[model samples]
Target: MGYYTQAARDVWTLLIELQPQTGDSGGGISRDEYISQVARDIQSKLPEVFDLDVIRKKLGLEISPTSVVLLQELERFNKLTLRMIRSLAELQRALAGEVGMSSELDEVARALFNGQIPVIWRKLAPDTLKSLGNWMIHFKRRHEQYSSWVDEGEPCVMWLSGLHIPESYLTALVQATCRKNGWPLDHSTLYTQVTHYRSEDEVKERPGQGCFVSGLYLEGADWDIEKGCLVRSKPRVLVSQLPILKIIPIEARRLKLQNTLRTPVYTTSMRRNAMGVGLVFEADLFTTKHISHWVLQGVMYGGRAIDSFDRRILTVYMDEYLGDFIFDTFQPFHFFHSDSGGGISRDEYISQVARDIQSKLPEVFDLDVIHKKWGLEISPTSVYCYESWNALTNSPSG
Candidate 1:
């Protein structure tokens, strides 16, 4: 069998075993039992000799343990899993109706219940953690990102979306620049300069100043490669992938703004409602258009799928869309397969849904009615329903 095939099978089996159930009878288990199963799985994955320092000393390689990527990655994974095990244990205890539950534990439980990923220290986006299939996909993406970094070794262009704490990396970049140039760390601040490279592979070397980062999605605007500046999004494109970005540390005193828009960067499309979430940073994007153009469009950068448009339309006009729906009355099986005897791809499905919603909207409400009744002012000419739907459902990494 192929390597990834075997890995997928292993994870699929674990997910089946991790299914949440209630009572002590049949092939069922409670939520705490599910947590216990995950804890045990994590324990099994951990190595007995995960401490690299001790391993290095014991192996008589203390002078230089090589600092291999595999070794470092293993150690990092071990630490992460160890913390997860501990947190899962605490959560399991709290699930048993135990008294005196800490606020953190309460938050964790609520996050899990609401289908959101939960970090012991902070809240993650509603990434469908309660849905094991979705969680598996999320886990695979994170693992792939980490493996890519490990294989590449201190990437020239980092994938910002793959990080759990992107601010930490951003801060570290400033710190490294400050330390290298002997500048006071406190006096340094970050300034982003967007590059023209479409992909990370195009970046051959690191900049002398800070770092190059990728995997940030731009909403409500697009970067014109030839012009090297922000422009209005394409006719049918709602979110556009930003090219490699040069994030440099500058002396706070020297920092100046000219013809740039201070764009907010959010961790996820859910915006502020997600736990422990807000604008992670404000990037100064080069723009020829007036800043108000983007501000009026609610333009921003996001870590993952940019779903603000989706939420506004989907949640508010849900009744209207559902009422006029001509498609098959939602069946789980129909989702994966098309009635035309061909399997529907994920993008195809998203497009189909978006088009269906788009077709129905004008029949029921025009731009004026929509804006007046719902207080949501969408562009009258905007026909990027596909992009909006993709942002809400299946935005592939950029």
Candidate 2:
């Protein structure tokens, strides 16, 4: 009823039904971990019990049985049922990897547990089979868009990778973005094109000074309030003409660390029911100065904010409780893994990042020549050296 599949909803009902949740159960385990418990007990063990009292006390069930089972038949199921339970748990674990992907999990469950397909698929709809097949369709297309941008040398980076808008709304937006960014995808991880984009329509200089995501994110341009199309305009700038982000810092604008995370953030391209068909048009409703402490780091490690917008996406907590559940179940997490390359030494990479920064924000004696690129009015100073932007902004004239 809430933003989940019927089966997923049942899993919630069943957990409370099977055992009153202790704080440990609620706080410690994730949805995937909790699902393992459901597969083991409620899925494999619940059906084995025929005793009315056992069902009532253990499973919290009150269903009346239609027929009585003989002792021999009951004995057959009662024996080695633990093995079956263990096996089901293993299956759920195997499925966990596939299901960890927010968009793909539903299709994985639907395929692996589709009753006839894997024989393991049971009538355990109560355990939340979660055949939200449509969600996967949506993300794959979004993934295509992601692959295109990241390959085209302009990765569609985001800071809060945890944000998963309600499935319906995300799908709608993904649909729109895919059409807009119809560039081809290149999956090779060997090399990435780090071009500079001045705006959505302007991408000049291949292997440009820095990587920039074209088009600033319109502060509140994209949304879904009671069913409407998404709106994307230029992201709000800190200054009138400058593209400096009010939300994200200048250092973060550097392309190198654009998608870097402080936590083991989940990153995946997912969508919901994308036939690659038509667009959903929504009504347009129109709608912070803060220097980030990490600006110097961003200048050194981050790319130029030549054209990119903030990677923050706002979500409406439809219900605080359900909203948390939606994020947990839909966002796929990945471990951080990077190996040192033989060609590009760490120092070399850092140097390249610095060079890229220099290229984008070259020095000019006259602020009147500013149309060339954005730079501090003071001196030809590398942003990496300036610890505080306040010091730079408060040049002698100010």
Clashes of each: 1, 17
- List the global CA lDDT of all models: 0.61, 0.31
* Count of clashing pairs, candidate 1: 1
TM-score for each predicted model, relative to the true structure: 0.49, 0.18
Maximum-lDDT candidate: 1
Kindly list the per-residue Cα lDDT of model 1 for residues 310-382, writing each as its tens digit: 4344333433333323222322222132322346666787889899998887432244454466455555454
Worst 10-residue lDDT window, candidate 1: 326-335
lDDT of 2: 0.31
Candidate that scores best on TM-score: 1
* lDDT of predicted model 1: 0.61
**What digit string (tens of lDDT, one per residue) describes model 2 on residues 1-398?**
11233356557645644553232345477544554554554453233433434423532343211011122223333332333454455557565664244333343333333211222322221121223243333323333433343235223332111112212222333333333445222211111222222233443333222122221222222322223222232354221111211111112122242222221001221111234212211111211101121121121112332211211111221222122333224244332212233456667777888999988995534433442355546454533434244456668963
